[model samples]
Target: MTEASMRFEEGEGFARRMDAEDPLRSFREEFLFPQSPQGEPLVYLAGNSLGLQPRRAQQYVQEEMEDWARLGVEGHFHARRPWLPYHENLTGQTARLVGALPLEVVVMNTLSVNLHLMMVSFYRPTRERFKILIEGGAFPSDQYAVASQARFHGFDPKDAVLKLEPRAGEDTLRTEDILETLERHGSEIALVLLGNVNYLTGQAFDMKALTQAAHARGCRVGFDLAHGAGNLRLSLHDDGPDFAVWCSYKYLNGGPGALGGVFIHERHARAEGLPRFEGWWGNDKAIRFQMGPDFVPLPGAEGWQLSNPPIFQLAALRASMELFDRATMPSLRGKGDRLTGYLEFLLDRLPSGFVRITTPRDVKARGSQLSLRFSKDPRRLLTRLSEAGVCCDFRSPDIIRAAPAPLYNSFQDVYRFVKVLESHARD
Candidate 1:
């Protein structure tokens, strides 16, 4: 058989062989994989966008629905895993995923909302030193949030929000450039807010080094962990940021529109006089049901909560967190690194200009996603790949994102993805 024909005939069996060897292969059964009308699984490589739902999520949510139907108001206290303290149960797992202490992390509102709340406390800007620095090409949600916040304070975002862009012709930002920007503007910057991983380029920033540098300049630091939460292991406590926020729907496998999570370092736990966006849920936990006029905030990250937990959303998160707890981040990250590296290796073997990896090649510089920038518009290739049953995502202009999630993706998935790419290139 010719090489191309052999690849097609042997690809599925080869991939199944790799799946058999995958340490995390068992985890794949935990999620509800998308199937064709005939019930066969589709090759899923879009975990970086919306993860497959955990099979246990329906059962978890069903329990809540039954409790609400049977117990009504009493469900808050009488149900198994009482609704009153439900959010607390997932803290330890969430902390483990993000490399922070249980007390430092909390599940609350969505990503953008948590960011605004974090800024209420962390973004304390003054007349001379009021600028905030962020990585260039950050998610539009973040850019809008920062711009609106700056405008709210009478600071022009054009001036108050300084973006650290890569040098001309470079796809990813360099650490040296980031640090240099800090060094030059550190004195005037109040807070350094950056994404732990860049969304489009899949570049994972050096959090520990960057946070430490920002602190030395007396600037508060925070992170938007939308891309890093499940894709990479973060030492959030050790890195010591003022706060961080992330969404659970991506690599966490919490389904679409999952609730967001937040982390606040323990050092700020008992801060008596910090500004916050207040609500009843953020009041003293002990006195929360007392229904009085006092405004006592809960300690640590929980203090940022402004409303009651969304039990249905929390149920989905809880189911996913259980799976995460069973498999730690280190093991997951290890698998992801190898799987993505394999994808990179195969892509590099292709002809020059046919495909160029926009995501950094260095293992330390990226997470599971390998962004491919085709020499021409990539949408045609994306549509072709989709029709062929290889699932990935396309960003505007020319980038296509493919991720190999350790939780559900198998080695064969990577193998087949390459197989499809080879076919697409020739077409």
Candidate 2:
């Protein structure tokens, strides 16, 4: 059916029909869904926060653990999937997920750590072009990271960090305003660092346009793709962003606090003296064990690795990346668009004046999440919904964020969640 003819009827029948027709419906069975007291799967719409664990996750971790116990030291090379090159296995899949070449991507430290490392290389500043431009209300961790980087470079956060804010009475930032800001201050701005998908508003920025505009003004650019990496179809390399960093836990389904992925555009891959913090793992694999005094860095993003990663974390991530490889990002994204559109259709029809969606109306401008702004406290409403077996999450004073993740969520799940919210609005 055409999107315009996709009229949503007021019943479970339409939802069921949509699910029955979905091509990716079987993918839901691959995950371990959490259940309420009645042993039924709750309407899980919080994959934006923590994805449901993949069924194969435990098995993958156990293989590594068993190898560690049996072979001990020899496991580094003798394990079922040898530990020395375990992270290398994830490089290609992760690169595919973020739309970059394998050489430009690497699985490494947590999100913020990678952000700081990227900043070390991309955020180089001079006395004139040292200002950092970023979106206002960025994730707190990113704000902290930018500020600390500025301070470490002998600049005050107040003077060095430039935050782009929304206009009064606006819920989200406008693209034109972003470009204008880049154009207006491009000469003095040393770096442009913004969240590709804003966590609070679910806004997906036009990274290509932003990157091109920044490059035009001689400013280096990067992105925090925490919410964009798996949630949206990205071309991090082709889009010409200098660097990008993201966590795999949210949309990548890599379990809580999983390893993050980084992209250092191939343009910076060489040994042409790019300044970065290095350790043993960042050294060239050929001479890494020789314990030489010289630090011979590896090519591309691997040169940024500080130490070997935690094995269990990589194992949990491997299980999910394998699933993504089979399902494919384009297919998952197709489903995500329809699933979120269904949620938006239902929410728009509600008679309640108590809340409004803060997420953008244009589907292309957002991701899988829909952020709702309530006139009153949304926490109580969220609590009541949870009691009724819903699993969406509440953010701060009034926003409730629901994400109908394409990999596992179904149309029926969206219907059930809205039904609960409609009931609360009536009360």
Candidate 3:
């Protein structure tokens, strides 16, 4: 293309035009963006880290506050969206977002906590085959939770945790290499836990193939959907993993520290009794108030709950889930690919080694986030990006993660981010 045509294609005006034509453009008004001290939008793009708060989040929280003031404890049953069946309202929508039946999903505790709870029931380890196989660069919280679970089960983490690192001198793990490791260690691996989309590099693993391979080896499998829940197209039920866990605080837009969700395959929901860490909430809903010592576990994913649900967090989550219901994951995934591709195109136009995209280039192999590795000091580039109001995330050592969430982020956001990044590179 001629210089004139190239300039026309990448100009700020072009970004504005793209935003104008965007189907999700109206959704941007739904979020409460962070502001500078001067009170302007901070150009927020870190939705993969923690999504922007939905405007309705305050109303959801206030509804509970009002209920507490008016109905007191009776609000559990009397409040609008009664706290008694509050989680039920979210279950169907949450399941739909991840492409599962209502019976397969539950919205409850925080992410790491839910992972441990699921492990309690699913990670049934024996003396001969008791190790957990996981990706090498897992989120620290996940590593900590898995290690703690191993210790809780009387196994040493150093011996029971089998980490799969990338091949030498590579940033991302190859799919073949991961499958080979699973095949080689299949017999001894009691559980195979991995991230659907890696938090750092944005590499999305193929869940269906991986789950099938793990199951063939007689190993239980689970996924941390923290980065993939709303950012990628996931059919949890069809994928057929033993279990999964994710936090709504990220792509689900449920505000900071929002309630996390868990999924249990339908097969296990009715299978002969299994061991689980239980609480009164896990008891049968019909006789929960009967206060019997006998714990009759509910039939599905709800059977895993361990305590009274967090009403306030659930409220915010409900608000966010409603938004996700209106915007489905498949549609979001389509836009995510284009936005990230635009980012890659822009980054590629820069001078050699100014920035390198560590995230996989295959659209099918990544979510919305792109990890930018800088030739200059990463911290310095981070400061420059911040000063320019292009909000993003930084992983230690050297990576900037910018996620353009289709729910609220526009193509214009991606264009602006690249403009700032290119300017910084030149500086």
Candidate 4:
């Protein structure tokens, strides 16, 4: 449906009609939602923070357990899905989800671990160009990782890290301002790292444009796709960023603390003399089991692996990826746009001075999340939401982030959440 035809209205009936008309509505049954003490499912709107567990995840994980118990050591080679090359099972689906070549993507360690690993190769700092550019107020983990990386290279974080801040009184960064910043400081930058979608304000960046601009300045570019992976229709290969990393627990619905993913551009697949911290698994497969002292790296993203992945994590993720492969990112992203648009429409009708959306109004500039900036003590509002059986997250100081994931969240979920907000505002 076109944006004009969405014709969003503020009532339960309208929400039910939209849910009925939704082509992807059946996908909701694939997930298991949290229940209240009264036995009703909570209106889950926090897919930006943690996605609901996929029902099939339990079954998949159980199969792996059964294999381990029945086969023991032999499971590595004889399990239903061999453990030795198990991560490979996820490669095609992960690559397609993020718009990458299979060779460029790998399921690996947690997000921060992969970020540091990517930095080992891509954040090659030199005397003349030593600064790393990132958006101000990046997710705390990223800020910590970038700061420590600079410190590891004997440079002060203050000098090595440059942050891009929004314009005065603005909540989100403008594309022109970002491009101009790159042009102005391009020569001094060694790496340009950004969250593909800002976790706080739910601002989505122009990866392709930024990559072109950064490359023109001779800077290596990377992104933290923690918020972008499943929420947005990414073109990681076409966008031409050097590398990117993301955790699977959130929109990917890989279960709590599930494995992370990495993407390295094909251009750097076999770049000679590229420095990295290598492990036995990263060695070329033919020689890997030969147990050579020398690390003969595999081509592309798989070459960055530090160790064999946990089988249970891979099993859980396999379940989620199978669902994604069937549903597809394009279809999921389309539904996401409509869901968030309906949410924004309902929110705009709330009492004007009570709260304001910090996320960009332009649909193209955001994913599913809408961050509400409250004028009062937001914690009180959070309490109200919790009591009402609404599930969303609070970001420090004063913001409540709600993301209506299209894969499982219905239009009725969005309507119900707003009704709670409406009730709180009236009080």
Candidate 5:
């Protein structure tokens, strides 16, 4: 059968046929999935949360452990991956994933730590222009980081933070309203900080437009790309945000609490005058061993480093990064759009008022996620999925976020997931 003819149809039979034709279907076997009572792999749709671990991660991690056991201190230089410059090896692939220049990206601390560090450098607040403009209902970690940053700079979170909420009776922020808010409050704002993708609503912002607007208003801009990076084909370099940070654990498929990534625009990559928290590891590489009590920072984003990177975490991440290197964002995204569109199509067939799809219907404005908003308690439905061996996440109040990641998830996985969802509605 023609591959095109096999794509995008309703029901289990067609789903199986489409899966048979998917070029990326084998990628799913590379990761381990949760099992059911019969010891069968469950239908997983929760790549938006913590992603499944890559089977290759074990081999990569074992190499580091063997080096540690045999060479002790010498492993720093002798190890296969070489701990001293481990992070450098990841630069090329990571840069390609986010579409940034190699010098502009670095793998560092966890998501929140990277966010605070970026804030320290770019969120320079003045008495007149001290406020931060962000969307309301941002991930709680971000809200806390911005508030503390305001307090540390001697401003009240109340007066120093401005939130842009959806219009009355709305579920997400509108881009026009964001532009208007910037126009009205632009002069008083020092920084425009926002999540590249709203975690709860799954709304992807027009980052290029937002960056241009903020730059016009004389504000430094940055993005928390924890939800956006591996999911979207972003052009961070061309988009021109001053800085951006993201975690590798979600769609990047690194293990939990895996290292995060940071990107500083080449324009500010080596700005000597930029204010940043100093650390010994960030000192110039040539004189790093000299350690002469004075600090001369590295030329680019690596200058933000605080210490030698954790080699174990970097190794675990390398396994999945290599997979991403093979699949490539464009190929994965092509399959992703249709896989998610099929999920949306089936959900639309749900009985009236059973749920609402909160993520943008316009595919350009969202990634793989579709936030299902149910009037009935979402946890109740979650309990049902849990018993039946479906792997999806439930958020507070009412959101069940199902993401069929293109790299590993198949059309039949989406079909089976919806079939179970339909069964619950009938009950």
Candidate 6:
């Protein structure tokens, strides 16, 4: 049902009815949830930070362990699924997941590593245009990576890096402001890198418009899809960003520390002069074993690989991607919008002045996450939530983030979470 037509009501029975009518309800059983000391299932709403483990992950990982035990060295070529080309198995699903052609996507190193690799090629700064543009409150790791990149290029970060901040009294950036900034500083910007979805406010940016604006200014554009990958319906090829990167651990439901994926537009698939840090795994398959001194990079995103990927990580991610492939992005995104909308509706019913939602109220402008900003210190409330078996997370200062992941979260879960908030309001 569309969000506008979906009627919401107060009471536990309404939540149960919504769950009963949900088309995706059965998918909930696919994951394993954590339990409280009393053997009750914890209300898990932290999928934005780390997704719950898929039940199939263990089975997929166990299969690889068996192959390693049975075939030893020969497992590279002879074992089921094989070891040498294990990363290849994830390519098609990875591509489909992010709306890119298979040649444009590759599953490889962790997020920050892939970001640096993409910068090696896309962030080609010159004497005239040598600045990088990013959000002011980007995840700390991104801040460090871009700043270090500026220093490596012999420019002072304080001068070379430009951070975009929201207008006074606002909690999120406006699309018009972002476009205007790009137009004003277009000449000086060598690269425009942004998180497609802000990790803090859960604001989804207009990547298509941002990419067009940056490209018009002769600047290379990239996105960290760390929060956007599975949470949003992305069309990287259509959006026309030079490159993008994301970790599989969140939303994609891969286990913690799982490998990340990268996307390089097909235009750069075989660009001969593009600068990249080459390694053995990125070498063209035909002559890779020749042990030649010269690096012959493979075509497309695979050309960016630095080494053979970790097999166990790939196997675990493969299991989760399989579910995503079956569920499809369109279906998941539709349900996600509804789930988050329902969460917003329920949260609005809490006592006035109890807490404020920092996430944009526009359903299309956010994913399943909502950031709750409170007037008082929230650490004690967070402790109380844990004690009550609620599984949301607290950011520093006064914000708490709760993500009702549609893949597994039920309407009842949202209802129950708000009930706890109502209790806190009374207290």
Choose the strongest candidate by lDDT.
4
lDDT of 1 by residue, 288-352 (tens): 88999989988889988899988989999899899888889988888788777767767777666
If both were scored by lDDT, which would come out higher, candidate 2 or candidate 5?
2
What would the per-residue lDDT of candidate 4 be over residues 288-346, giving only the tens digit for each residue? 88898999999999999989999999999998899899999999988998999999999
TM-score of 3: 0.96
| TM-score of each candidate structure, all chains considered together | 0.95, 0.98, 0.96, 0.98, 0.97, 0.98
**Per-residue lDDT value at 81 in model 3:** 76
> Could you tell me how far off, in angstroms, the CA of residue 364 lies in candidate 1 after the best superposition?
1.0
lDDT, model 6: 0.91
The whole-model lDDT of each prediction reads 0.87, 0.90, 0.86, 0.93, 0.90, 0.91
Clashing pairs in 4: none
The number of clashing residue pairs in each candidate reads 1, 0, 0, 0, 0, 0
Give the per-residue lDDT digits (tens) of candidate 3, residues 1-427.
Answer: 2111233256778778877876767878988888854477877889998998888988999999999899999998899879888889898798889989899999888999999888988898899889999888999998998898889889999999999898888889998988998889899899999999999989999999999999999999999999988888889899999999999889998878888989999998976678898889988999999999999989889989989888899888888888888877777777677677766777788888888888988888988888888878789888887887778999888888889888888777778788877787777
lDDT of 5 at 78: 93
- For model 3, give the 10-residue run with minimal summed lDDT: 1-10
Cα miss at 373, model 3 (Å)? Answer: 0.7
| Clash total of candidate 5 | 0
Taking the tens digit of each residue's C-alpha lDDT, what string does model 2 give over 142-220? 9999999999999999999999999999989999999999889998899999999999999999999999999999999
Q: Per-residue alpha-carbon lDDT of model 5 for 206-257, expressed as tens digits?
A: 9999999999999999998988878998899999999999999999988999
Tens-digit lDDT track for model 6 on 161-185?
Answer: 9999999999999999999999899
After superposition, which runs of candidate 4 have C-alpha atoms over 4 Å from their true positions?
none
Judging by TM-score, tell me the better candidate of 1 and 6. 6
Candidate 5 is scored at a TM of 0.97
Ranking by lDDT: 4, 6, 2, 5, 1, 3
